[model samples]
Target chain A: MSSKKQASSQLRVGDNPLVKWLLVGLTLFLTAILLVVPLIAIFQQAFVEGAAHYFNSLLEADTLHAIGLTLLVAALTVPVNLVFGVMLAWSVTRFEFPGRKLLMTLMDIPFAVSPVVAGLLYLLLYGNNGWIGAWLYEQDIQLMFAWPGIVMVTVFVTCPFVARELIPLMQQQGREDEEAAVILGASGWQLFRRVTLPNIKWALIYGVILTNARAVGEFGAVSVVSGNIRGETNTLPLHVQLQYEDYQAAAAFASASLLAFIALLTLLFKAFIEWRQERQEATL
Target chain B: MSILIEHISKTFGQFQALSPLSLDIQEGEMIGLLGPSGSGKTTLLRIIAGLEGADTGRIQFGDRDVTNLHVRDRRVGFVFQNYALFRHMTVADNVAFGLDVLPRKERPSPSEIKKRVMHLLDMVQLAHLANRFPSQLSGGQKQRIALARALATQPEVLLLDEPFGALDAKVRKELRRWLRGLHEELGFTSVFVTHDQEEALELSDRVVVMSNGYIEQVDKPGDLYASPNSRFVFDFLGNANVFEGKADQGKWLNQQASLQLPKGIEQQDGQLYVRSHEFFVSDAPTEQANLPLKVVAINPIGAEVRLELSPIGWQSKDIWEIDLPHKAFDQHGYEKGQTVFVTPKAGYFFADDLAQPTPLHW
Candidate 1:
């Protein structure tokens, strides 16, 4: 026992034994340089005037309107995308039909296409003098350079985020559970509600949170369509860009800090879900 | 009246899964559909469970023609090989799921549903795991919960596909007996599919042997083992020594060896299969009436001895297997690479149908 203890003590740091701490030290060093320094810099730059001035600047009329529009767009886009994402995941995973592969490829088009290019495609379809735009303008149904146009572009740009997260998850959880429920005399609706929904609920919620974050931060696509009407169409990202152009750096960072806080909350929620799943697995 | 299938045929694209199959299952009879992989046993069970449809067939359950009925309307319970329990729901909720589907007027109250779920959990010996999720249970526990869930709705027929195939050897044996006891107690009309013949012969009241999309034979376990109808059925059910020999007036000769075939065999140029246990090895000249064999290898299993034997010119030929009781081997004291005389009692003979050439392969 004494020999074992002495050997263990000798095998500690700088003992030149088989075990080494070089990898751990290198990882920590890299993370501090690559991530922590920049985050600290951003926080210091944003909070230079402390909470008093920061709160006052955020409460300004234009800035407040921009934040409200950003939230409204996210609230509209997240739930809509959640429902469509689940439906799309179900169809792409469970069924076999003509154009199935094409549908799968089309779901990823949003990720591959640039945000500016996406806004341009909708402009081609709904802008005045465009194919569908001429007929729409005749009936006084405006889309481009309006609230509807901003939402349309935002949906196009962030459409795949939710569905993409759900497809692989739904595919891994195949028809087994649903079939078991049906064998238990469950109706289609009951099976979806009780058995199917509970299994994919976490992934679906994570996808919605991420989609909301993406929707709030989107600037190029929304700016192309919003026309930057200060109080009406300007969302948080556009408002920040406008502030930077007007040389109001402190106010821009202050608003950017709010978006950053939301992003941090989303990350925390995702990490909590993953940690819970891991804990459950460890118990099993 | 129970369930009757008439002339069922199914094909997935170009591959035929089942071909004009017909079977009848009696009420409260626990029958097993025994076959290897891709032998259409699972397909037949799926068709009966309403999980799959036969291309051209009529299924009658009592007086109802349920061939085209939806799965939810069939009222049949199916247990998958993997158990297929919902990983998110607790054990009680998984069992009470079917009870929750009844109409409001006909449905049981929440407390009543709880009592029924508890009763089901007790039946499967899983009452202690009532609140645990499926991922939290062992394989045996999951299977028990799946069985309880299947029985929850009081289904007319229960179908299981390789119920214990995924379990360890010891667990599989224990569950086989447990399942048998459960069937005896509940008297459910069950059809279980498995590739293991021992499992089929042990658990089932009657076994249906299938191969290549067609059922070759169906009979009681003891009778099916003593006498199989075809070479495929015989070889698949157990180990056998198959010989392709010619008949000359009165005696059958081995194809490439000098040993005379067993007496009382039919005078036909066909294949003959004899169970390994039916033949006994003895010293040369000790039994003049027995056929001479050269023992090539000896492998001792639990209580039996597997002997790989060869005839006179057995160098370039099929090897014959012989299984002897450990007591018999110890009593005779026959060592490997020694000459021995063997005799097999005449039981059955069948022509090999797999010898036929396929047009598609050509």
Candidate 2:
């Protein structure tokens, strides 16, 4: 008992040895079973036949096209969500108006609703038979059952990440610095460039990273809207499912492995950016 | 430049933040907008700086109507309460921001801008920390840098919202003296908002006291101190002990306690306000006065010894506090639980619902 007392610092709460070991043991055990094992299984199954088979499966035309289409959707969706997210965050944080609280509550809709439901909603609203889509169909435009539909649903599901990361930060920093800049005779553009942009740049970057990660990995929403087209509309995750359903387990695992690798990279970027922002605030 | 404000008022939603009011400020004079929070002092300062527009009336800066001008075009310097030095910029860059943002046709050359920033830095006496980011500087240093940044464009008017409010007492005092000196040297029209009465009295050439969105009084510091026009001003300016009673045969009495009203005062029921330094404590009640209090606490640590007393027979809203000079306290050798009679040397008496207080002295 004396030894245990000496081992634990007084500053810490929940300092019982048995409780501490139980919590740590449960966390590590659950992580290995739920997360680590699945990640390892993806790579093992992908290379089970042989490294040559795994590489050849990845090099197939449909797989390559899926990868290309996923990248394009992410590239397009990220910038669209980035602009929309920043504008949403900036408006909610910086301005006061009627229905502002309602607007803010509305921003969280994508985050709360199921991604598949979000996709279905978009399909109902923007499909060829849908109200707005009927007009666009006459003009020979197709948003659903295509790459544009995939990108649209992807953008919807990913829009909140950037805005969610930024609102608290911008609110904490407050409008004092911007007001000071304005009083110092800075034009609107200059105030944003010289004052507002620099402070929020790190959080902005962090948000963009999360948005990209979600765009690349989104499956449920993209599935409902994508129509499962083979080479033209299949994203990485949708392609993985198509491969598995076609009895190509190795190809499915290979595609899933690529997603796991991207997720790992995104985590690394997120950690580094969080550390940079911590240092920035510590200095302040 | 002189500033003339006419019938300026503002409302947010349903709350009237400021009532229509007007004042003229002379060039090179320093004015303090003194009021408690929600009294609209900060709102008025922001309005004058063009950071917030008044819902009605016009503002003129020496004959130029600035009522419709954007904050950026008003040509006034403003220092925020938090200093608001750009967190990402070094001290030099912060001070240079005002000059750097000027239109190219009017902007100074880079070398000239650098020199001007350095000169302002030297003026604030922290030129050596020019390379340090705002976070690296102390609170007092950051405040000076904020001032230098505000002054960089050489605007003819300066506005500050609680300039030294974030600093410790010692730092606040030091900066108050420094800012006053800078104001004298620059000779610009200056206005600052502060709820700290000592800051207002010590630093302002004149103080404008406001309450509930109304201007209560505007006078030189000494005159304002001597003659507060309303109850809000009287209570806000200092710690005061109040005497509530009715006049009977020239003596104002509450319960068994009563005191003679000075001659030439008409008979009326009202509350009397007295400062701690304006009354004296003695062993027995005089024929003209009887105010009995028991000392509950004695603190002898500061400039004067302080005593916390409670009324013996009369009623008071709070515990009465009285200050005594150390020499007198030592001579009297007062102790806790000792009863004493207090007599008023002077006070301001307000009649029922009267706006002005009648000054009384003995």
Candidate 3:
């Protein structure tokens, strides 16, 4: 009877015993080597010497400065992306216009283009020798090769996260609730805060988490514009690279562990939000 | 309040959703905008609610001109098809939203808002559900809560977009009756949009039937059903059968079937339309008409026996339907594939050039 049941179940797609085992084995092997090992390796190496050593390396002045600068960049980047993302999603989903489809395509440019290319584009426009940069240089406002440069490139690279997360959700939830609120005498702000925001809270937070994760860990773009100036232009990722190049392997891994920790935290929060959202939908 | 809409029109880029049209809704009147999909009935209702702007028009609520007013400032209570209740808020908060959103000076006190919400909930007979989320309620319960929420601010005009569309049939009928009672008790001017002929006929004091972004007819439900102005309205009302024939010498002719036109209904190139209920089946041809049709199917259920018939000696692209009282059906004992004669007791005749159909009776 059990064998018959198994045969019946195998009638479904991709349920053959050998094929399933092969696929599962391949997936497990690849995940263990490609993802699990590297993640564990970072933490393992960070504390290889001792917890005291790890703390000392992370608490170094340059490392501390790099940490603060990374947090600051994320702080500036997340809010800008959040506002821009909500507006873009709202416009494309709620209203119709000639360029609406084109605008949605344009929003995905940040995701499509290489982060280094994005940084280079910003540098060319805002660097010292470029057209706009020459004018800014005369006014003594430097954007590239400084902390501001890091923030700008990070913003450009992470801009699509919030909007990407929000677009499909807002499209699904639709403009009806907002319309209802407006017809019930809700002002513009009231409509958003009361009707629109509550429906999208989880998605918006998920977007923020993605944006923050990308902003803090962004390397290719930040490298192009940051100039790798230790204690000044250096972010944590840059500092980790510099430390690795200087042959301070343990210290580098210690700093890498911080980014890894944040990534883990982001994953945990994302899972929780997804679970909560599922519960919410089940109740509905 | 009476709503006076003048020359309202809207065009969405290449597609014109609404052409230049107007409607006058009397004070305390419940009007229904009824049409098929994409017929601009919802668009007309949205424009009236100020959820959408009209291209060229003036909207006057009572004596107040509100053509350019924003929806938030219009003070009109609007309910959406899916209830659109705040999912994050409890039913009480959803009901109190309108009162809470009023500008500071005019805003009711927190305690007053609570009392009014409870009172509204009580009126809808869902006061026990005040603490529950909208998700917890059934479709009918949610609909009642939505109505109570809409009434919380005591607006003079209420607009509902396909109010009971998503409910089951029994719930829809119940909600329809409940809404009618509420509308009468409140005495608020109301306009609702629906594609349902039955709902519009049962609930509205006057129904505005639309087709292809234009108003087809506007009249009391009884009058509208009895005399649909155009062919579109006739088809939209459902269960209508048409016989395309030419009229000559006071006789409508198609093949061997001939139906004599009533007095003053003689016209060239007319199409006769008959509702299923308006036609009668007899074992022999009547003096007024001779439409020999073979019974394709007989549905003996409900209050009547419905016959699906195909013509025996006439040409109709579609099959014809006739309904008989069960007693009559039992007496005749009609069966499938049996030849029977059908006479349209009452029908409307639409000519090739005329927009309005002529009512015909034998």
Off-target runs (Cα >4 Å) in candidate 3 are A1-13, B248-250, B261-268, B284-288
Clashing pairs in 3: none
Candidate 1: pairs in clash:
none
Pick the lDDT winner.
2
RMSD of each: 4.9, 1.9, 2.3
TM-score of 3: 0.95
Of candidate 3 chain A, the 10-residue stretch with the lowest lDDT total is: A8-17
lDDT by residue (B31-78, candidate 1, tens digit) is 889988999998999898888889998899888999989888888878
lDDT of 2: 0.93
Task: Summarize candidate 2's per-residue lDDT along B127-168 as a digit string, tens digits.
Answer: 999999998999999999999999999999999999989999
> Can you list each candidate's DockQ?
0.63, 0.87, 0.80
Clashes of 2: 0
Choose the strongest candidate by DockQ.
Answer: 2
Model 3, residue B235: what's the lDDT? 90
lDDT of 2 by residue, A1-284 (tens): 98788767563776777998999999999999999999999899999999999999999999999999999999999999888988998999999988989988998888899999999998888999898898999999999999999999998999898899889999999999999999888888999899998988998999999999999999999999999989889999999999999999998999899999999999999999989988877877
